[model samples]
Target: MADFTTVVSDAHFLEAPRWHEGRIWFSDFYGLGVSSANEDGSDLRVEAEVPGQPSGLGWLPDGRLLVVSMTDRRVLRREPDGTLVTHGDLSKHAAGPINDMSVDARGRAYVGNFGFDLMGGAPIEPTSLHRVDPDGTVTEVADGLWFPNGSAITPDGVLLVGETFGNRISAFDLTDDGRLTNHRVWASFGPLPTDRSVEVVLPALAVAPDGACLDAEGGFWIADATGSRLLRVVEGGTITDEIETGTPVYACALGGADGRTLYACAAPDFHAEPRKAATEARLLATRVAVPAA
Candidate 1:
């Protein structure tokens, strides 16, 4: 167990946390918007709103903010004038709602999708991860990913994607053209799930990777959606440490003035109807030794 304090408790459901510009920015999945707050979770403010519900978040080289509109499968960019415009339309290439994204320094966004009807309890489907250029050009970077959820990019340009249902993190090398290649299993908790059904795959998972954040130690802190914990993982899938948050942790970020604060988005459940109906979601924080990049 780790010491944690509640920073914000008024959200419906939060995901995709990013530490930037001296604040913790996150997407309220059911709240249909993006928000930011101070280090201790004070001074909460609505940064932007998306009708389709926002998920991932990133900033371009020009300081423009990019937000993922999940249901609509699009990336919305916030201009300098506070306008929300379509940066990329991923619906054509994505099989389902886009969930999370990792943006490169050059403004290329690699995005993942649910790959199936989650709320509808449809069977889980393998999907492709799309690379969206700053000019709104979309292309399939990799295919046959199992429920790709959260992602992070290393300073060395390796792309690490968390497969929520696959219980593993997949790695890819980024090309100059913003394409992903040379796929390898960066980390595998156990084995490839024999069951193909979402119901079975979900239950069989030991650690359902949700959102992720890179630390200064060149490792990742991952939110375990079903495990009620956060794991600090190094290369080769070694679980270095674990932070046990009593509730289900959907996302995490390492940020603060010193970059040691670990922020988690937690809730009693992630069900669509229940989480949206009640404001049980919260932003929780704890201090860690590893700082954010």
Candidate 2:
């Protein structure tokens, strides 16, 4: 019965939370590393640090970590013995900084990027998405996307991606062998950006299906980075409920032994001029329905 009003603060700009090996692993974009903690946010530890800002995070099927190094446009891995190795360099394909990613059960990772230097005082453009193989080869999967961000793979092997700037989610059917096939609209956040100004559409996202160990129903939990809310989406993609907060919520994940606890990364605009981290930018948590697998 812990309501959303109970805020768990100061998670250091966390993103891409995943429940693995009895711990909640995630990234701190500005902090430039990955860390984890118990479901209760206890025993927080820095699992690994990338030289550039680390955004997306996931584990290989064998349990090695795959991280997105934003500034360097590379995918890095942490070996079993805690050694960091370059898994792949994507500088040639990524238009700007690589952002979030989702690794399939088969170990293939779908990586997204900024597409354009939105913070570089230039005209905005849509970003692109890529499929990165285990051996470090990069292939352009999709293009003409506005700030492609959070992504996830369904238990049935569908690929779900969130377009932060577009305020919608898309799903791509995965082949039996793990290749992306059919592409279609999954859901749209038409009612989001309640403010809907030119500047309010920039929120980071992390999506999970319902009946999940963390969200035991069919819906997506979205961190409304600029909206200051964590909203839940039903199977057909409807906002069933919403948790309001003072901080602009960024990305989210479900963790904890039972997978009912939700962790959110909150942060101010890292691309903002004067570049001040919002004091309200911190991690928050709450107990919720079990997550979908």
The digit string of per-residue lDDT tens for model 1 on 233-271 reads 987999998989988999998999999999999999889
Off by over 4 Å in 2: 1-12, 191-216, 268-280
| Superposed model 1: Cα runs more than 4 Å off | none
Candidate 2 weakest ten by summed lDDT? 205-214
RMSD of each: 0.9, 4.3
**lDDT for every model?**
0.90, 0.70
Please report the candidate that would top lDDT against the real structure. 1
RMSD (CA, Å), candidate 1 to true, equals 0.9
Model 2, residue 243: C-alpha shift (Å): 1.3
Task: Encode model 2's per-residue lDDT on 111-136: one tens digit a residue.
Answer: 99877776674444677888888898
Residue pairs with colliding backbones in model 1 are none
